[model samples]
Target: MAIRNPMYCGKIFIEKYKDEDCHLVKGLHEPLITETMYYEVQDILDGKKRKSKLTIMSPSMLPLRGFLNCNRCNRVLCGSASKGRGNYYYYYHCSSKCGYRKKAEEINKAFVDELKLYILNDESKEFFKTAIMDAYIDATKGETKDKTNWIVEITELGNRITKARELLLTGDLDGSDYKTIKTESEHRIAVLEAKLSEAPVVAVSPAEVERLLDKAIVKLTQIDVIYSNHDTYVQREVIGSMYPEKFTFENLQHRTANVDFLFQLIYQINSTLREKKRRASDRKTCLPIVAPEAGLEPATL
Candidate 1:
C-alpha cells in the first residue's frame, strides 16, 4: 500500500480522495525517492510494465529467426532446439496457436537458394555499376550549388537579426516586433546552418567512386558465395538487405518475399534484355509487335 501511495513521494490529499473538491498538496514532506522512481514501482505492481532489456539472439544459429513469418498466422517465427532420442534438433515455429513449423536446415537452404536468384551476371554487373555511377554523378552535380545557396541564406538571416537588434536599440521598432524578427531569423539561420554542416568538405573523386562501385558490384554478383562463407551475423545482414520485409516459408521454399529495390531493378533490366535478344533471334514467331485483332477498326471522331 505504501508503494502505491503518492504520500511516500511527498504528496498529500487534503479533501475527499479523488473527489472533484479534493485538494492535493505536493512537497508536504521531504521525498525519500523521486516521483518517477515511485510511479515506476507502482507500474510494476500493477503489471503494466516489463524489463526493456533486449533479448539477444544466438550468434551461431537461427540467423533467420525473427525474419521468417509463419505462413498460417503470419506471425514472426521463433526458433528453438528440441531433444529427441538423446539428440537435439532445431526448428523454426510460430508462437501463435497455428502450429506452423519447419526444420531450420530446410529453411536455411531455401533462403540460400532465394539469394541465388538476385545474383547479377557478368554483363548485368558491369551495367549495374555504370548506371549507379552515372546516377551518383548527376546527384552530386548540384551539391556544391546547394551548399553555396544555404550559406548565402544563413548569412543573410544573420544580418537580418543584427539589423533587428539595431532597430530595437534606436527605438525605431517596438521591443515585441524586434524580438519576433530576431527569433524567426535565428530559426532560419539555424536550419540553413544544419544543411551546411551536412555538406561534404571536398567533392569525391571519380576514381575513388569507381573503386567503391567495383567492390559493391562484386558483392552483389557473388552474394550467395559471401553468405555461405560468412558467420551468422553477416548472414543475417545479407538476409536483411535482400528482404527488408519478413517473408513466409511454405512448400519447402520462400514465398512472397519482397526483393530490395536495387536488386529488383537489376534483375528486371537483365531479364528484359535477355527477352529482347531471344526475340531478335526469332522475330517472326513473336507477335508482341502486332495488334490483337486481324481487322482494323474505324477511326475515332
Candidate 2:
C-alpha cells in the first residue's frame, strides 16, 4: 500500500496526512514513481477500474450441467457419468432428492431440435433483415452524434488550456490556478479523446451493412448446425447467448425459456406469421410492424 502512495513521488504528509493536505516536496529521498503512475495505481486500488471475473473450466462432457434446472426443486441440475457393465453413461440429474434424471444424449438432441424452432422462414427473414438494417442505421446515427459532441468538447478543452496559459502570462491567473485549469482540462480532453476513438468514425455504407446482415442471417438460419458443430465449450456459449436463464427439463421436454431479445423477436415474428398463415380470416393478414427507428426498443409483434 505504501509503495505506490503519493509519498513515493516525494509528497510530504501534513497534519493528519489527508490526500488534499499533502505537499509535494522535491529532492525528498529520490522519487520512486511518476505522479501519473502513482494516481493510476491509486485508481486501481480504489476500484475505479473493474477486474474481470475468473473463469472456471467446466467438464467437456457436461456442457448443459449448469444451464439446466431441476423441474421439481428448481435447483441447478448437475451432470455426471456412471459406469455400468464396463460402459459409461452420462446423465443430467437433480441436485436434490427429486430423482429427476435424463440421458445426456437425449437432452442434447432435444436442445438441437429446440434451436431448429428459431430458424427464420423466408418471409420472416425478409422482415428481420429490413428491421435490423434500419436499427443499425439509427444506432450509427446516435454514435456519430456522440462522436461530434466529444470532438467539440475536446476542442473546447484545448481552447481553455490556451486561454489559461494566456491568463497566466498576463498575471490575471495565479500559477496554482493556471496549473489546476490545465490539469483538469487535459484530463477531460484525454477522456473525450478515448471515447471518440472508440466511436465509429466512418459511416458504414448500406451495401456493407447488407453484406454483414447476410452473414448474420446465414448463421441465424443455420443455428442448429452451427451449435451442433461447436465443441461443448462453444455449445454452452451458444446456449447461454440464446437463453439467459436456466430452463427445466420434465417428461423429456425442455420448459419454456426466456431467450435473448433478438431471438424473442425472431420467434415472435416467425411464429406469428406462421399462425396467421394457418388461420383463415376476412381481415388482411398484415405482418407484424417493426419500428427500427425506435432506439433500443423491442419490435412490436
Candidate 3:
C-alpha cells in the first residue's frame, strides 16, 4: 500500500555490497524521510497493515465491504444498515475516527464505473494485443543477454555470501551483522536460481496468439460486467489481480491506480486517442505505443 523504500532515505541499497548493514547509510542524494520520520511511518504502517478478512458472508446487499479501505487511516471499512421508514439504508464507515462514511450503493456504483476506463474499442484493443504478442514472442528469441545478466547477478551474490561467512568466522563482523547480510544474499541467490532453473518459454504460434487475443478481448470488454455480476469477495479478487496494492477511496471516488503498468499502458493509449482528431474523411489514426520492459520496441500504426 505504501512505498517506504529505504533507498529514498539517503541510503546506498544493496544486501552485501556495502561494508555495513543493508539499511540507510550516508548517500549522495537528499533524504526524503528522516530517520525519525521513517521509523514513525513504519510503526504506523505496521500497526495498520492487516490481512483482508476472508469469512464468506451469506447473500447480502453490501458486497463491496472489505474491497475498500478508509482513505485516511487505511482501515477496513465496516458495513452496516439501519431501517429507514420501510426500507433499510446501508453505509460503510471507517473503523478509525476519520469521520469518513459513504453510502454503500454509491461506492459500489462508482467502483463499477471506474472499471470502465479500461475498456478499449476494436481498433485500439487489437493494436495493443498485436504489440503484446509480438513482444512476448520476441523476448524468447534473444534471451541470451538476459540469461547472462542473471548469471552475473547470481555469481555476485554467491561471492558476497562467501565473504560474509568468512568475516563472521574471523570475528571481523559480528554474528548478527553476518546473519543479516547472509539472509539478504541468500534471498537474492534463491530468486536468481529459480529463474535460471526454469524452462525457457517457447514462443506462442501465430494461431495461438490470435486465439489468446480473442479470449483477452472478450475478458477486457466484459471486465466491468464480470465484476458487477460477482459477489463482494470475487469482485475484490478481480481488483486484486490488476491492483496488487490497496488503493485509496475518498470524496465518493476510488483513487486511480499508480503502480499497475497495464493500467498505465491503457491510459497512454487513451490519452493519445483523445489528443488526435481526423478530418472525418480519413478514419484511420495512428498512436505510438512504447513499453521498454515489454520489449521497448514501439509500435506506430
- Estimate every model's Cα lDDT from 0 to 1: 0.80, 0.80, 0.70
Whole-model alpha-carbon lDDT for candidate 1: 0.80
Write one digit per residue (lDDT tens) for candidate 2, span 1-301. Answer: 5655567876765554655664555545777887787777777778897655677655666778888888888889989999999998899998787899988888877777777878776789988998788887887878778888988999899999999999999999999999999999999999998887786566667689899889888888878777778787788888899887888765226437678877888888898988887775524555545545655886554
**Candidate 3 per-residue C-alpha lDDT over 1-301 given as tens digits, one digit per residue, 9 for 90 to 100:** 4456765566665666557665446788898877776666677678864444677662356766766678778888888898999999898878787888988778767766766776655556866776677776677646656778989998998899899889888999999998899899889889888987794755566678779778877777677778778776767666666665655555326446443666556656655665564433245433334533544665443
Error in Å for residue 166 of model 3: 46
Clashing pairs in 3: none
Per TM-score, the best of the predicted structures is: 1
Better model by lDDT, 2 or 3? 2
Candidate 2 RMSD computed on C-alpha atoms after optimal superposition onto the true structure: 17.0
By TM-score rank, best first, the candidates go 1, 2, 3
- Summarize candidate 1's per-residue lDDT along 1-301 as a digit string, tens digits: 6667778778776776464576657865798878888879888788899856876754455888888889898889999989999988889999999999888888888887767767887868777887788877787768877988888888888888888889888989999998899889888888888878887765577789999888888888888888989888888888888877888876326345787888887777688778888888788666566455544785333
Q: Residue 294 in candidate 2 has what lDDT? A: 58
Tell me the lDDT of candidate 2.
Answer: 0.80
What is candidate 3's TM-score against the reference? 0.51
